[model samples]
Target: MSKGKRTVIVTGANCGLGFESTKYLLSDKIDEWHVVLACRDESKGKQAIQQIVEIDQEYASRLTFIELDLADLDSVRNFVTNFNQEKLPPLKALICNAATQAPPNISTTKQGYDIVFGVNHLGHFLLTNLLIPHFAKNDEINSIVNVTSDTHDPKNGTPVPVPTYGPVDKLIIPPQETPKRDSRYATSKLCNILFTYELKNRLDKSDEFKNHFRVNCFNPGFMPETSLARYLDPKLFNMIVEGEGKKYRKPIANSSRYLADLVNPQLDKVSNGVYYDGNEIIPSSDESYEVSKQLELWEGSKNLIKTETDFIL
Candidate 1:
C-alpha cells in the first residue's frame, strides 16, 4: 500500500523461486514495487514476509499477502474480487510463478482437472484472463511472466522423459499408471509456454493492449534445493538427474534475479512471447511454437475453465 508506487502480484510467493524473486524485486529502489504476495496459506505468506523484512525491515510496509489457491477455480475468482475491492495501488503486473509436480497416483484439482496440469497451467490461465481487464489501470507496459521449464524439450537432453501432448480432453485426465510423473510434469510446463504465446497473440490484436502488455515464458532451470525436487520418489529422482545434479542446474538466487529483471518497471523494454532460459533469451521446444497446438491448448483450456469461472474475454 505504498503511495505513488505500482503493484505486482507474485503467486506462490511464500517459498522457493517465488519468495526469492519477490526479494529481488523489492530490492529495486528505482521502481519501488509494492508487491502482493499471492499465497495459498496465510501463515506461510507471513513467514516469507518476515524473512524478507529480516533482510530489510523497510519491506514490511510494501508487502501484502493475499490468499490464492490456484488448485481451485473458485478461489481464483474470489482472489480477484477481493483484490479489486481492497484499496491498493494499481496492479501493474502478474507473475504466475506457482507450480506443483505430479503425484504417484492420479489426482485432480478442486475443479476436476488433473492436479499437475491444473495448478501449473489451468489455474494460471483463469487467473490471467480474469486479471487482464484490471491490467489496463496502468498506461505503461505491464508484464505477465509464466514460469515454465527447460525439461519440456527432449532436445535439451534432460534425463527425464520429454513432454507428450495429446488431445485436450485426455490432457486433463490424469493417467492411472505410475512412472509417468516426469512426463506429466514436463507436459504441464509445455502447456505454460503454449499458453504464454497464445495469450500474447490475443492481446496483440487489441489496441487496448497493443503495446501495453508483455507476456513471456521463463524457465528457472534445475534447482536441486527446492521442494519441487524433494517431493519426487528418490528412485525417480535419481533416474531424472542421471546421477548428475549439476546438469541444467542453476542456483536459486541467479534464477530468481533473472525472473525479477523480466518485469522490472524501470526497464521498459518490450519483450512479448519471448522465452528465457535462466538469464538468456533462447529458442523453446518445437512443440511450443506450433500455432495449431498453441490455439488448441488455448481454446481447450478456456472451454474448461470458463464453465467454472468468469473470464474477461
Candidate 2:
C-alpha cells in the first residue's frame, strides 16, 4: 500500500452514476487518488475497471475492486473486515452510491428488511458506521457522501409520490409490500438524507471528529439513462426519460461531476450536513431537519445493526 496517496471507496461502482463518478475521480485526478471500486459482483467490477483502463490505461494501477453485497449484512461485515486487513492508506472519502429501486414485487434482504430500505439505506448506514474508525484515523480532511434523490421529498414534484413516512419505526417495519415499492424506494432515499444529517451532527459533536470528518448528502437530480430505473417498465421508463424526465435529467457524466466535487479535499468551507443539488448546496426536505427524528433514526439504526451483526457502532 502506498502511504502518501489518498484513498477513496465508491460503492456500487460497476455501472451507472457510480461508475461515471469513479471514472471522473480516476481520470480527472489520477495522481492523488487510489480508488476502490466496491461492487456486489466481481465480474462486473472487473469489467468496469477494464472500461476505465480502456479510457486511460495509466489509471489501472491506481484502481482495484472489492466485493460488496449491500443487501446482506454479513456481506457488509466481510467487506469491512477485508478492507481493514489490507492495511490501506487512511480513507479520504467513502461514497455510498449503491442503491436499488425495487420492482413491483415485495423483496426482502437476507436479514428480512424491505429490499429497497435494506440495500439503499440500512446497508449503507451500517457500512458507513463500520468504517468510521478508519476514517477517524486519517489526519487529513475526509468526507462521506451519501447519494440521495430528489424523490426523497414529495414536495419536490417527483414523478412518483413518496407515500411512506419516517421516524425509524415506520421505515424499518414497512407497512406493506409490492404495490408500495416506489414509496419504499422514496422512503429509503429519505433515510439516506436522515442518516447523513444525524451522522454529521454526531461527528460535529465529537472532539476527535470535528476537524477531520465531514458528512453530506447529494441529489444527482434525475439521470434517466442510468440503470436505476431498470425495474420500471422499459417503454414507460424510456418515454419518461425522453419526455417529462428530460428537463430534470442530466447526462451521467454531468451528474457525476457534482459527486466528484463533493469528494474534492481542496474544496473550501463545506458545511456539515448540507445537501447538494448538482454542485449547489441547497436545503433538503423539512422533515430531514427534524432533530427528534434524526436522533430517533440514529438510535434506531444502531439497534438494528447490533441485532443483525456482531459489531456495534
Candidate 3:
C-alpha cells in the first residue's frame, strides 16, 4: 500500500453509476487516491475490479471491494467491523450510493423493515453513523454524500406522492408491508433529505466533531439501465428509456460523470446541510429542513437499530 494515498469509500460500486464513477475516479490518475469500492455483489464487484485492472494494472491495488448489503443491518455492522480491522487512514469521502427502489412486490430486509426504506434510507443512515467516528479524526476536509433524488421535491416534474407511512412513531418496522409504489419510494427519498439534515445538525452540535465533517445530499438525476431499472416492469423500463421515456431518462454514464464532478472538491465550496442537483445546491422546502421531522427520523433509526453507538453529537 502506498503510504500517501487519499482514501475514499463508495457504496454500490458494482454497477451503473457507482461502477462508472469508480472507473472514472480510478482512471483519472489522481495522485494517491485509493477508491474503496463498497458493493453488495462480491462476484460483480470482482469482475469490475478485473476490468479496471485490464485497463490499468497499476490502478488495481488502489481499488478493492468490501462486501456490503444495504438492506441488512447485521451485514452493514459486519462490514464496518471488518473495515475497521483493516485500519485504513481516515476516509476523505464517503458516498452513500448503494440503494434499491419500487419493488413490484412489497418486501422486507433481514432486519424485517420495508426493503425500500431499509436499503435506500435506514441502511445508509446506520452505515454513515457507524463510519462517522472513523472519519472524525480531524481530517482537513471530510465529506459524507447521500445520493438523494429530486423526488424529494413534490412539485417537481414528476409529482410522485410520498406516503406518511413510516416506522411507527416509536420506531418499529411493522410486520405488515405498506402496499404502494410511488408513495413508498418517494417517502423514502424524502427521508434521505431528512437524514442528511439531521446528521448535519448532530455533527454540528458535537464538540469534537463540529466543523470536522461535512454532510451533503444530491440527486444524481434519472439514469437508465441501472440496477434500479430491474425493479420497473420490463416493458415500461424499455418504453421509458428507448421509447417515449427517452426524454425522462438520461444515460447512466452521463449521470455518473455529473455526480462525480459534483463530489469533486475542486469546483465547489463545502456546504453542510445542503442539497445538490448536479452541482448547484438548490433551495428545498420548509418541510425538508423541519427540525421535528429530522428528529423523528433520527429517533426512529435509533429505535430500529436499537444500538447504543455514539454519534459524537
The numbered model that scores best in lDDT is 1
lDDT of 1 by residue, 160-258 (tens): 678888567888987765454358788989999999989888988887777788899999988876778656778867765666556777899999999
Ordered from best to worst TM-score, the candidate numbers read 1, 2, 3
Residue by residue across 105-125, what tens digits does model 2's lDDT show?
657778877788889988998
Which scores better on lDDT, 1 or 3?
1
Model 2 RMSD in Å is 2.4
Residue 179 C-alpha lDDT in model 2: 64
Best by TM-score: 1
lDDT against the true structure, each candidate = 0.85, 0.81, 0.73
Arrange candidates by lDDT, highest first: which order? 1, 2, 3
Model 1 TM-score is 0.93
Query: Can you give the lDDT of residue 11 in candidate 1?
Result: 96
lDDT (Cα, 0-100) at 102 in candidate 2:
79
Please, what are the lDDT tens digits per residue for candidate 3 over residues 55-157?
A: 8777766886788888789889988887878656556778888877756665777887778788888889888888888873643667788887776776675
Provide the lowest-lDDT 10-residue window in model 2.
173-182
